[model samples]
Target: MAPLESVRQELSQQFPCRKDQIQVLSTLFEASFPSPPTTVVHGLEATGKSVVVRAVLQALDVPHAIIDSKECITTRQLLEQAVAATRNSVHQALGTGLLHGNQIKCETVNALENHLEKNIKDVPKFVLVFDGVDRQKEAPMTLLPGLARLGTIIPNLSIVFIITVPNPRLLHLPGTPHIQFPTYSKEDMITILSLDPQDIFLERVDEERYDYGEEEASEDKAWLWPRYCAVVWDSIGKGAARDLRTFTLICYNLWRPFVQPIVDGTHGTRDFSKLLVSRRSIFQGDEALTGKIISAKPSAEDQNNRSKPTFLELPYYAKFLLCAGYLASYNPPRQDKIYFMKSTERKRRRRGGNAGGRASKHRKIPRHLLNPSPFSLDRMLAILQSILIHPVAQTGQISAQIATLTSLRLLLRTGAGTADLLDPATRFRVNCSWEYVSSLGRSVGIELRDYLAT
Candidate 1:
């Protein structure tokens, strides 16, 4: 048997902040034989519940079969597969595969019990783990309680159920021990994430060391990474990041960009507040914080190059909404009919005859150069309908898309103290830069210059 301390240490290394759970599991499985009929490791998703249990069982060289009940929804299929898996797991550990017995078919709870009683009861020791047992096509009313009491019938067998929900009453196993894994706290998250601090820059270019390890990187490791995680938690993880898996993915996508400015000497290593201000766009908007990372792996050359993020793809109607919002915000309301309205009237051009007036003395600032002016939703929609080739979609659907844009911070809602969402007076302004909207127009094959009034 592996030393208890070594096994505990191994588990601690694999899963940090799980010392109590590890201690309990080690004590439960490490003994020669066990008591309780069932052990449940339950918690919210991605809290290291299943992984931690699997690690501890492996550390002690325990023979166990972990069946994901989620894969086979049917009760009969689940029962048969569980039997087959249990047999394979036990025989492989016992080196009795050469003398394999006839396969037993178990479709119902009664038959499953009979098979386990006659065949599996004679085994020295065994464990069966069911992950996500609540996900069954057939309601698992009797099967759960049946397995929960299976240990009394077969002393050699121990059963474990790994679940994501916190409803222990559903099991109805009174004496069973429930090991719960709660969602990680921010401090715990920072500690866990900082365990493996990734290097920002890999290559040594032009004599100035770009290491996050020796001098600057040590600070980056100890100081920068934690603050960055705290910022991420504040922006998105507080609500959207339900699990560590998704939270980790978001961090990975933003980490490279967050550190690029520092690597370029645009900001100092100690200017954390400034760094956050500069990189606000990357995390401040719902679009960046909730968006998925591109799946394509960066090439070696591309990875070496300091590449900035490109434009993320938007929905088709969303493109039109953005373009229309830009036009409505920047162009004067007086010129709306001239550019947007369909007409055949030609007007005479203005002659530069040196007219003497205060207007001529003062050069008027271009509308595009000034801050965006708020426009009514109806006017923006009218502009959108005129430009779009396809018929304007349902009003509710369009409204929902506009709300999505607002949440993304692409468009700012200028209305306040208003309860009616569809009020004619509700106004919004484009929150994007001129160059950005120009690029968006190009992508959609629309020349924005033709529609401009300035």
Candidate 2:
């Protein structure tokens, strides 16, 4: 299959869209004929931006090229490539007679204008499909002016730019009108997964069954159905559903031989630890194991306290999550607390009190110590440390960082452990402190802050 066809097939299987959107884009392509005007489609990653562009091209039966802006090392390089490719393709289709003695000059905006002028004088219409437009670090701001100029200079030449980006804030570019692709809903995700090639799904199902004994498999189809559904739901919720490639990877990992054997024998509890380890490896690789050891190792204070440290080498991502306070105890005994923290003072007091005195006096109630709630400075520091130490190549680490940052700002206002932390005045002060600290220091920027805070 052609590259675009394969991409189209993948998109058709994974993305949720109304038939009308596909029809409209298809119709637009069918009607298109080497036009100079451009339409821009922009959205978050895995939201089907490139797929829509490819679908249109396929429907129109036109040969087009797709380029990723992010992969370009510099703006000038990207512009040079885009201009050269566009000029070469157009010039080839419509010979020198249409050139009218005009040489194509490669000044960013001027080149685009010159191309558009030549196209109008020459070919009926032409399309240039630019994918990953927003990914160019500087092109959006620098090259957009020339692109906008095309609207007035060469109305006949059509351009379709498709951008898949993580930040919606980037859409504020001048003269670029874009259609945003929203994140898929749970129902939409389910529907898309159901439509996935049966063979693919069955492969996952078969892999999941490898550890099951024949007798056990015969008795519990009902239980297995929910397990499959849960896996699908979790996979989608975690952002794997957006891209078929990633989703397939998730399925392969979830039902891999190593995990299935454990799942088949036990009621999923044994699998939890393995799942955590696997997820860490998937997200962090060797770095995660290193982070786990670092986190599990006894802290300096733990050594002085002479208590068995509760810290165990957690998965690096889990440690990151815990540090960011994303993985808080569900319905903790104290609403203000995040994780359970052992109190050295209480332990000391209990040891001293137990030495003598009335039974009641010696038997003082142990005070429970819980980690301060999410958004505490301690948690933020822990998360930041994990990110700094862990390898940066992990998928979803950046998103996880951002989510943690958002959670931190909210938590700071609530105070780490103080009951008075709920006061509006205290919360406001905490927010201001976060803003001030983040603005003044690179270590506390929004991205880092979010990772730590969460």
Candidate 3:
């Protein structure tokens, strides 16, 4: 009781805003037995799932092993790693318990089952944590169910899963209770990051200051870091790096220079307006927003490249699919048979002619100016097949490419039935502009104006 209370008091301060999770995990493990065979700890990446769980176990001084799921590429590898890690934990906790690595032979699940049933009788309550098992290379469906069943089957053992994606389908079995670590709120993030104020000038010792300036300077830095974090969140974190890890990295990268003017005595800490005006590049630069390496210094050529608008890098077929979507939206359905016969016939187009001349002089609205109309999946597919010189080997590949385009928002799925791909009439519209799609067409050596029915 004293130990649990002491650990609770200590860990609560070490990890702010995770009191509930710490309490739940502590209670579960401190009980007569950590019941229910399996406990799931799920959250978005960098939300402190792994670190919090680790802190609790270490603070409790409990026997545990955290095996990274990335290390387990196959079920055989997973089993071997699991057994070795479990045995190592038992030895660490009890000092002289459980069979050693060489003594326990496990190349398969059955061998592991035999070893566990025969040799794990004298060990204390142990927790074996698999971090990011849901993201492992081996399929979680087959791998996890078997592992969860093992936890149920084995005595004096418990399994914990730390996962990024909180999919219920993967955790639909009995006796599996999950703990969720939500994304950090603005206040919590600011509080957590205020732990260490960056050394703007790297705290150079040779640089001299006032007698009590050390104390006052420390006070000022503490005051300034939280405000800087707030400004960063308002300008960048709210839209781009919401996760703690990336947000923290970005802050560390930018902090040194952001406060250099203040350190030089040119601007006071409160003059954030002057600082923002002088360092406007930090806010508007694409490298910070586009996920370039945090500490990476951009070359002169890279800086030149950043000045240009970012181009979406798509798969070879995805470009054609997007082009077809644009054509289907702009061209009249009646002209489809004339321009693009069936999949078998060659497309008909005059060498130097484009249907752009077919527009009415007083047509109220230019086709490009009007919003795109929705076209069926079949219509887009027909246009895509017609435009290509060679027939695609399989439509499964095409369906996948359409899904990719939809995700990138180049093609927007329309109509009310939840955008079911199984429905042949699932309609989509072009979300790109004429100039954009026209440039895309020219890149692939096709003129988009030749197919328009304006």
Per-residue lDDT of 321-410 in model 3, one digit per residue for the tens? Answer: 888989899877988887777647665654333368664455355577888999998888889888886888645888788888878888
Per residue, candidate 2 scores C-alpha lDDT tens digits across 167-209 of 4444333554455676555555445555532221222334364
In order, candidate lDDTs are: 0.78, 0.47, 0.77
Worst 10 residues of 1 by lDDT: 345-354
Candidates in order, TM-scores: namely: 0.60, 0.43, 0.61
Estimate the Cα RMSD of every predicted model relative to the unseen true structure: 14.6, 19.9, 13.2
- Report the C-alpha lDDT of model 1 over 31-85, residue by residue, as the tens digit: 5646356888888877888788888888878888788887886888788777888
What does the lDDT come to for candidate 3? 0.77
TM-score leaderboard ranking: 3, 1, 2
Higher-scoring candidate on TM-score, 2 or 3? 3
